[model samples]
Target chain A: MNFKLWVKPFENLAKKDRFTISILWVAMVLAYWLITTAGEKKFFPTPLQVWQGFAALYSEGLVVHIGSSLWLCLQATVISIVVSLVIAYSYPIPLLRPLSRAMSQLRYLPLTGITFYLTILVTNARTMQVWVLVIFMSLYFITSLLAVIKDIPQEEIDHARSLKCNRWEILWEVIVKGRFDYVIDVLRQNLAITWMMLVTVESILVAAGGLGVLIKNSDKFMNHGRIFALQIVILLVGLSIDYTLNTTRKSLFRYSKFN
Target chain B: MNIQYEEKDIILQVENLSISYGEKVIIRDVNFIERNVVRKEINQGQVVAVLGRSGRGKSTLFRALTGLVKPSSGKVLIPDYSQAPSNGMQPAKEVEEGDVGFVDQKYTLFRHKTIYDSLTFALRKSGEKGSEKKEKVMKYLIEWGLEKVKDQYPNELSGGQRQRVAIIEQLLSSGHYMVLDEPFSGLDIGNIQNARQSFKLIENGHDLNTIIFSTHDIELATELADSIYVMGYPRLDDGSLGTVGTIVRHFDLKALGIAWRTEFTQDHLELVKEIKSAMLAS
Candidate 1:
């Protein structure tokens, strides 16, 4: 790996917004230190204690919890994408439009409440919760897809037709080309939301080990420090996931107008 | 109205073609035979203008000609429809391969796509390969005065620039039968001239297609049309839009109006002038 490639973006960032950006960074660090230190005894251990906990957790099969949550989120997200594509393609047809719209509106209901309500119907609450997680997020994904498709200009369609492109070719070529920027934009904005949904579902529904389970179990004994430390881990994990997704989207959609 | 062709062959024959939206009929029983259509056949080398007032169905006529719209009652037959319509002229059904190029009225560039990508997409669809597509699309862009704005997105360009991009895109596609819907609307003189130049190049360079378009500008129509079809008039009692005043004037209005007294405004007054003068003097 060329360390220089990694350093170039920081160098440009420094030149562009050096003063305000550095000040903001320093402020954030100071704020984090104070919050973690002040709550060291009751809620969080000291910064040093948190570090030691991280070191200790690394050897104590913490990997299982991390891996499981990561796997579930990935699974849920993939399911969401497929479901979204189905909704997008189906909703445009006259017969399915009303049903798709109704389902999309229902997605706004509180996830926890829906999970609890659905639990009565299914024998296994965890499985139902996972499916519900996928379905709920998929509704949002479908809405975004619809917006992207609808926003494509009619001229592109006409141009495609004049060129003798079949209906399918028009969809794949002009319409897709026209609205690709919005699709990438929607994906970028929703990466964090997907992770948040994953953690929320895992925390409330999963019987097995996950970061959520650790936090919940720690909460039972009122071990506030461990709960706070678990949250830090979750935050870092969510950030890493978001960063990876954004970078990938930016690279893939480089030809898109937004770049 | 019956259309008689003396010598010119009818390229597009619209027999009693009428269009309606719900209950209101927009144009009814329109009839005409274009002159020199056989001898002056475009061979894909001519540009024709369809000029009319707003709401007169100029765009509708273009769509009807291209079979995008189903006429209420009539037939549109493209006589001598080219076997290999130029590339990028996909209609609902694959008739013969009569390609038609369309520049939509709206500024329909993909807002998120860079100029490079937009042109690339159009060129690739036209079966242009490798560096040829790039060279041709870029050549049109430069010729149409889009070199400075080549890297910009649709949103980044001005209205004229965006429209030129749309024009260049269609030009690169290189369809034989080109139909532009008010291509000069909202453009300044220079952009309009540039767009016209680009269109002229397409027609002259590719002599396998005929171009048809609609506009509200009489000047443009007069400048570009090989034969003008002026279509703003009410149907007479006989269920035909009477001859255009210019065409009627050409046919000796006095002789044609002898049978219909009420229709002859000047002749009726001329006959009654002697009696009216005596009454006025008394």
Candidate 2:
């Protein structure tokens, strides 16, 4: 094969595609640098200061804080998901309807404002923090899952029943399998809310070694660079989780693309 | 009137079947002495079609037959193969899964499963094992020309493909009989012809698979059904709604020289007209 012939295909990209691929990241970085360094009395930390703060925090073991926060969030998320699934699936029974209704109404109560009540109930600070996060996140979980469960077409259930599936089989084959992708989507969306509530939860329980505690300590000492750096870390972690979830959902439900 | 078939040939019997929702009766005294009592005998290998307009209880009747809906006072009798306790009587009981395969109007295939997996799941449910399960699934896939899309999910297939897969899945799972609710509603002409061919093939190949599908299309029903059951809203003597759907007419097409290949002649058109009138009659 001639060298030019092989190179011609590679050079066939549109000007717009080339600009987007090469220039978008550089432009974003330049914008960030200008915004952080332009002012005389800096409200935001300079990029150099933020980078140094990140290095200092890393040397002092900030990974422990990140790990603890992530572990707590994961635990609360798994518990809330299981409980929400139970509530949503049992919503049809008349006896459970009132309980579900009560929970739905409770979602309107502000999560952070209820910290004192949770503290009173569970005096141990760490336990109280976990409880608050679980309760806060589960409200959204229950509501979203209830909507998903309700949106399951009756025909799908009847189809499973017609195939000789008993109640449990219908739950597994129809409800779970049918809503698998949507459930992951719901989790991905609600996980952002959970992370937003994490700082509030961990700040209340100062002894808890998490990013929220680090942010709280930084806030108290007027360490603006450390605050900005920790916030950036949190954002990156959240975005990474979201990207992973999105990729998983796409791969698992490739068939949905054709529809 | 009781239309009796020989006991050995009888595949299903709806005995005095009356179904009601609260006080509003949908099928009142389906096979009793009262008015609107439907007495019919379905034999093995017959393609029966129930024709009716919307809300005429055709689907309700099918639901009752398949044991999805509980009848108010009557029962649907299917041969209880599990209970042959040497009483010299093959007792009949309510329909159960593996007894009657049902396909709804929307061809509800498992979205998560591929065509091959769906068939294998059905076979597995019926206790087929290992190579036998794979062989049966492959056989049907080849037989129906579905081998090409065997690994594709239901959403990846066309509407016609989904319907065929639904029918084939039901056939493999529930071998003896199948009930379909509005199986041909949304299908195009090409798909309808394809469906007809599949049904014909199943009927000819399997000696025991009796297909019962409900539809409002008079022409399609008349063409496919060996016997047609016309359901309509019954009217009392005083010009009031009878609160139930009754069989207005039952046509044994074979007796009238109607076959799968029967051309639409003047007599057939007349019969279609009569069925339409009966379906619409108060």
Candidate 3:
């Protein structure tokens, strides 16, 4: 009876998400054109010149810098995961809950300046950078896990006990199950924050060979094309990781909303 | 199903049991027993419901039995069986290990786990391994009408369905005496009926299965239990709950003092109209 009903499918194409997706597609196309159209040595270099620069870097045995940056991030992320897991599990013990919670809230304290100062005092650049990155990322990771644990309802705890489950069984089964989605959600959100922290860590003069260093060096030389290229590389990497993690989260909880 | 076995003479024997939470005593020297609790001499299944006004030590009795709350004074001796202490000073006695299943007043499904995971977690932890355990879990799930939601999260389930899941978890762990505390609380009529039917199937066997629960719903308790323990507020003397008097009652409709009341089909009420009438007649 309603013409709107017949046109609903087409009408949905104009909705916010679809429109946003379309806008993104157009923006990417325009960005590609703008960068390519800009002559070499201008405000933005051609995509080919940027690719050649990347190729040249790889050929010149500068790949070690990329590997170093990646290895550092990997170490930091793995350390953060282990440290946070231990903090989260330890929270159930009578004395640990409050202590862990207090430590986690301390994460809200500015990590950037803390990392900067700590790096200066430590005297060694590489070890200092790794430790600072790990410490800063671990705080947020552990806090997020604790928040998930606290969010679990008492009803769920009672249910596990009634089944004649011991303390560990109850924690593993009921408490963990009830709060895992939120825990995963927290992890996904923190991945971005971790990278930002890592960038800050890289920006320090103590450490060498990271994307942050490249960007900083380009800015100092007033090499706009190199700056743009580095920015693009960082954007692409961050976007890819964010997309993958988000998709994994959704797939893991397709039947229900985790958060 | 008739539970075919040699009934161990005294299934449960509680002698001078007392329970205190923090500084406050909840249950005190409550000497009670079901003489010939499980008797092959008489193969009859029994369900007991403990009903009382809000603060009358119903949950405390269950906790005391399982040793969750330690008894302040008296010793609880469950005949000739003792295992090492687990989670408390009292050893998980033979009677305590798999003998009692407690359905807490609060829903206790694991937050991050699905119904299937909750069930399997208990079995695996309790030294149940291999395909047989999985089969047993699957069997219980289907029997309990939870096959459809076996993979669903606890938060997604309705209160009654979650309760069923809890029951399934309990049963899968080979719990003999299912002690439910206010399981029917916060449920609608339809949910209550469904819960009743589910419970009915589980408690049908003669020897192995017995259900004991504390409930405020006097009518449902009366309908389900073979015997009922009803308590009133014990008078307080000098800041302590004194043992004054208990309005001891029993429910068997064929016997006098037990009759269904309320004219409305939809509305069920617990009134002592007939008991009072019988008293007046006497």
User: Interface RMSD (C-alpha) of each candidate?
Assistant: 3.6, 1.4, 3.6
Model 2: clashing residue pairs?
B30-B38
Local accuracy of candidate 1 as per-residue lDDT tens digits, B1-282: 222223333444556777776887766665544322222333334456665445556676676666566777766665444344445432223212114556777767655568877788766656657698788877877777788878877777877788777766656664555677888888888878776676667655554445677676644544454444544544467777533211110111122232112233444444334323322222
Comparison by lDDT, 1 against 2, better one: 2
Worst 10 contiguous positions by lDDT, candidate 3 chain A: A1-10
lDDT of each: 0.61, 0.78, 0.65
lDDT of 3 by residue, B103-157 (tens): 7765566655788887887686566666877888898788878999889887789
Q: How many residue pairs clash in each candidate?
A: 8, 1, 13
Instruction: Please report, as a value between 0 and 1, the fraction of native contacts recovered by candidate 3.
Output: 0.43
Compute each candidate's TM-score over C-alphas: 0.66, 0.81, 0.68
Ranked by DockQ from best down, the candidates are: 2, 3, 1
C-alpha lDDT (0 to 100) for residue A20 of candidate 2: 66
Q: Candidate 1 iRMS, in Å?
A: 3.6
Summarize candidate 2's per-residue lDDT along A47-69 as a digit string, tens digits. Answer: 77788889888987799999989
DockQ of 2: 0.47
Question: Model 1 compared with the native: what TM-score?
Answer: 0.66
Per-candidate RMSD vs. true structure?
11.5, 7.0, 7.9
Docking class of 3: acceptable
